[model samples]
Target chain A: MNPTVNNLAFSTTFNAAGARYRGIVLSANVGIMRDLAFNASYNIQSAAYIGIPQDILLQNTNLLDGGQITGIPLRQGTAGLSYQQRSGFAARIDTTYVGSNNSWNRNPFWFANASVSQTSGRVSVGLGVYNLVNSAAQQYGLIGAGVFVPQNYYGGGAFGGPTSAIQPGTEEYGLPFRQYWLTTKVSI
Target chain B: MYHNHGYLLSDDFASAKNDVGFGYTWLHQANTNGQFPYILCNGNTQNVFGTYPPLSLATASYFARDTWMPNDKFSAFATVWVQRSLNTISTHFDPRLSLVFRPTTNDVIRLTSGRAYSEPDPSLLTPAPPSYGSPTSVNCPSTTTGSGALVAIASEADPNLLPETANDVELAYGHRFNFSTSIQADAYQSWENQALLSGNVPISSIAQITVPQHLIAINIFSA
Candidate 1:
């Protein structure tokens, strides 16, 4: 994490000698009042390199074979705000947006969540939400190794490889990411 | 010697893997001699070190400091850190804290307390596996891949091993130089149990392995 004290910046990423990804970011904060205030910031990142971890691809360039994989997110936005009362009552809503990701990472969608609560009374109850949009989510991807094999000792079928019913990327091995759970908390 | 229909030399090929006292040391790659898949029982050595002697190791440390405060007693600080290992079966989390008190103003002295944590990077302490592995994975290429490197580390997940833990306490003092800018400092410390580290042993290293055709490298080492 390079520490750059900047309010905004423009950056670009290249893939296969082509302008793959580029983006601009905008952010600012101001005092709407004193105790009850508001602040919001948005980022617009567009790049053909959105879903892929390019560094990994670049590192293996010298391997025995080839193919190309890259990700692109046409645009993305993130914004949120909060409201609080001196009475210990507070509420907030947040938005995590992907502006129509046009690449393999998938379709652009926004996820919104909100919460409200008041601790003024004896019994306090808080209700929260997640994945309000319930947009289909992809947790991860499966990639295969190839082009060269260490002589003929053991093909990819070692490590109990083809022998066992277990394969990491296989659908049989549950992918750990997509979800929307409802949780509630009660305090006395 | 060839008269018996066999090419022979004085002790040319000694495939004496059956020697009783010859122990195998765990290595980075080739733990299987490229014979058995990862966990298949192929009569290979259960372990290179064949049950390495319960790994035994130890460490000790000490520190001292002199501090000053307003009441000639306001600024005070002290701390100590120590650890040890025995038979590759050990863990400890220890932290120390101390402070002095002085009253330059009415609100200078403070009673403080807190909980400190020294969890190793889940990746470092334990193995953080990718959801998937490159086709020709050396250690973990399949879902049998690994829950974490720690799982295969032997040092961790040795059913006998316990989750490391630690606890801490603190006390401090400070003063405001002005409204916008001020000087504030605190003296603190803690003691912990089960700090963690990889108990991994290295054996023959992995050479180069490639398979399929689209092979894209995630991490590989080649000269």
Candidate 2:
């Protein structure tokens, strides 16, 4: 059937027309002295919705054009330092930061990690700790779309409400808590 | 999901200044949801949901690539891909090109541009056919609502769905300060089209139900 693309109302999956993403990434590593080293990396990115799905746009009153895409961080950075000795001992520490995205304008969050290793002969052992500071970082998604109220539902029927009562369209993921691991390697 | 069968053949040719390769592949796949109830109308007990028949798809792909290093300081790589979906009567052609230059012993620059396409999930291509809840009968109680009242609910599949696609370009540079130190930077931009997502289509858009239906059908995004 040759139904208008926007008016063919059937619950189904379809393709969105347009989106754009642009970003810069930088990373570096340096050897400071005979036993010390340093490294860092930073990334900045931006995403925009150039066009909205025709059906969704028609169902909602608000427009999302030129708005930041949901679920993407705008900035991220990491820095690390390491120390090593000829005696087969090494240790390293690292920290990471992540900025908020278009959905929410909250403060940035960060976490740290540390690890140490010792190698003797053919056998070696190591210990590592992740989320060293136990930071409680969280991620959020986009707001819910406004509910569509047909003209017939104005006085009767059971379906009508403000969109504010609905939750965000996506789930929130919490960063993992602090954890530790011990590793060993043996050469045959 | 249905079973798949396919095969691939490839060959590579290498020389002092160039490396080339070619390959071909064929695949067949299918899917079904068996049977499950999707809607209940007027407090009826019997399952009124219906299901769709199994669906299958076949595809053939061919690709060729080559890397040429004309000298120690410059190189270029290119590849081309052609894919055809048999049942869908669709074909896609994708191409990529990359260039690399080493102006110094410890410094390098690279640039790349490409277009890529991803097929939709097989399950999404074969959702259960649309069905309407059973009407009021002797097996169920009837309220003041009109008789033969029905509410349509369905998980639909579109055979005409197209693959998602993206076009991207990237530039990068790297430098080494010593045997143990190095740095790199990159800039990139991309445009994506035909990204797929689940959405709702009010039944009112397709037909009108005279009776007030109390049950709201949830749109299932997963199996």
Candidate 3:
């Protein structure tokens, strides 16, 4: 239609006109020593700027909800400390941060996964906790633009207050907090 | 004032005796997995289920611009506005300096400069079909599945989407006649960034969106 381009309203992988995006990637890193270090990498994306089916996500709500993808912040940051003791053992503890997660897109999460590894003989074992902060960051969503207001409501009744002539459900569902996890691995 | 036009008068503004007020915002930008988790669809763009970005956006705002008139020849202006909510209301301190060049007793040249946040029109943010009271509705083309992705109309909200931020520069000229009626025309241009947009992605069946508590999006300048 002739609607103005305002919200990134459409879906990705299948976005419409104003939704076209030329995706990109970003990687963040740091080190306290050498091999005993910590690093993180994230996928930077906008949308299907130069394709067609890529525009579907922007048009169909059912697809956006089930497609396992959406417009989110592909951030995975880490903060940890690792060490090596030559013939003894190697250990490490790291903190990771991921923001802008959505539910319908299979990405409602921004958690921390810390770990510690030890190498004794030919095998190396490690364990760590994830979302250790104990956060229930739920990923949720709502209809994009089909809210029916009851006329008398002050906000216009949809979802999200900005347009809701009614003042209800201001704090909708969608969490960008941390959840915990446990991980382990062995090396030979 | 910082937020309420009178709140900028003190340091600890909460319980001040003045007319100043207070406000707050979550200031949390969408980082990952939301209504449409920003898929690393590519390099410069992100896809939610797989959509696209927009070209330009249009918006409307209701704000009380502060005005400092140091007499009549010189005056100043600034404003603190809240678009989304009481919690999201911020002092978008738009401080402006103007010169009242009165070539004739009935004419004046006004030069104004300041930063402005062009908020989305309530109509745009509210999820309505393509049209209003009119019986017409924005419908998908008759084409079911054919050529390239021609339509990209998402049925959800892009909350992380931010209100367009721009440096508003306005040059206005006002003229008043003996009849006390004045007509003013403003020539303006905005150097803008972080503008919000919505594009229709050519999805085969549907699209996904995140709309919970009105998602609050902000741009944090890291120095």
Error of 1 at B31 (Å): 26
Tens-digit per-residue lDDT, A86-135, candidate 2: 99999999998877752233346788999999999988899999999787
Candidate 2 chain A lowest-lDDT run of ten: A149-158
Ten residues in a row with the worst lDDT in model 2 chain B?
B141-150
Please give, for residues A1-188, the per-residue lDDT of candidate 1 as tens digits. Answer: 12121111111111222112233444433334544444444554432211223332222221111112123343455666677778877777777666442333334566677777776556555666665555444454423211121111122333343443332223211123334444445554
Candidate 3 positional error at A58, Å: 13
Candidate RMSDs in Å, in order, are 23.1, 10.3, 23.8
Shift in Å, residue B82, candidate 1: 5.4
The candidate scoring highest on DockQ is: 2
Off-target runs (Cα >4 Å) in candidate 1 are A1-31, A39-79, A95-112, A134-136, A139-188, B1-223
DockQ class, candidate 2: acceptable
Q: Residue B16 lDDT in model 1?
A: 28
Best by TM-score: 2
lDDT of each: 0.33, 0.67, 0.39
Backbone clashes, candidate 2: 1
Fraction of the native A-B contacts that model 3 recovers: 0.11
The interface RMSD for candidate 3 is 19.6
- Look at candidate 2 and tell me the lDDT of residue A97: 82
lDDT of 1 at B124: 28
**lDDT for position B216 in model 2:** 28
